[model samples]
Target: MAIEEKRAWIMAVVTIVAYGTYLALVLNAAAGAPLGEAPYVYAMLWTIGGAIVAAILLNILAAIVSPRDGGKKDQRDKEINRLGEHIGQSFVILGAVLALLFAITGLAAFWIANVIYLAFVLSSILGSIAKIVAYRRGFQSW
Candidate 1:
């Protein structure tokens, strides 16, 4: 697999695991209280930070493992990346709209924040999946 593809896989898996970990911690801490009342800000921040660190570390590991790839990016890589980003960004818009609706409806800040965070996570996963699929199945030029 190309180094980019490997990186995509790493991103997807790491995002899922980090977010899952955060969700578990937050939900456990809620302890039957309303989700809005749970201490989520710290957990979300920590998980986001941890995910960034882990992604950097794992990317370094991936590079070391495949020194021959040398983290090169050609035309195909660029195109695939653009396509993946285009596909993934839809969720961000969706999330923003939903958050706006929540705000207008007087929903808790917690819900708004969580919705935005979930959108980011979804974007990352979908983007990575698109890149991986393009790498494996060949990107179409249209």
Candidate 2:
């Protein structure tokens, strides 16, 4: 497989695992399970940490395996990352709008806000995964 393909697989796997953990935590919380602090707070921390660790470990492993594939992202890789960030920003905008509308209409509860934030978080994870997939599938900077 190409270097980009390997990177994409790694990113996709990590994102899937992280998202699955988030879903599991949310479901457990809804079932009255204690999060040891607060539901949203601990969940947020867990999700963020998982993403960070996943990226670090996977990147390190890939670098070790393919020393020729330096971690320096090329132009194509950079563009893929930019596209991912664009998608993430779009999600952020959606989340913000939902938050604003909820506040203005007095319809958004704390839990609702939390869910909306998580929605953005999930979207970001998926966006990264999508970008990686594109890179692997040879959809270069376009």
Candidate 3:
């Protein structure tokens, strides 16, 4: 697989794992209380930070394992990356709009934060999936 494809896989896996970990931590802390009452800021921050570190480390490892393939990108790779980013960016806009509405309605910070976080997670996963699909199924740039 190309390094970019491997990167997509790494991103998807790391994002999913980190988000799952965050949810589990928050839910467990909530116990029987409201989700908003749970201490989530620290958990969310830690998980996001961990995911970034993990993705970077994994990408480094991949490059170490395949030095020749590292840092190699052609027209197809660039185009597919652009396409995947465009596809993923939709979630970001949706999240921002939802957060704005929630804030305007005076919703709990928890809800707004979670919405944004989920949107980012979904964006990463979907973008990674799109990139992987393009690589595996052949991409055609218009």
| Local distance difference test scores for all models | 0.94, 0.68, 0.95
Q: Which of the two candidates, 2 or 3, achieves a greater TM-score against the reference? A: 3
User: Candidate 2 residues 28-132, lDDT tens each?
Assistant: 776765433335567656876888798788877888898876766677777777777777677777777777787787763655556575666666676767776
Cα lDDT tens digits for candidate 1, 1-98 = 88999999999999999999999999999999988999999999999999999999999999999999999989898999999899899999999999
- TM-scores of the models, in the given order? 0.96, 0.69, 0.98
Clashing pairs in 2: none
The lDDT ranking, best first, is 3, 1, 2
lDDT for 17 (candidate 1): 98
- How big is the positional error of residue 108 in model 3, measured in Å on the Cα after superposition? 0.6
Residue runs of model 2 more than 4 Å from their true location after superposition: 1-8, 32-38, 107-109, 140-142
Candidate of highest TM-score: 3
Question: Which portions of model 3 show Cα errors greater than 4 Å?
Answer: none
Give the residue spans of candidate 1 off by over 4 A: none
Score candidate 2 by lDDT: 0.68
Of the candidates shown, which would achieve the greatest lDDT relative to the real structure? 3
Clashing residue pairs found in predicted model 1: none
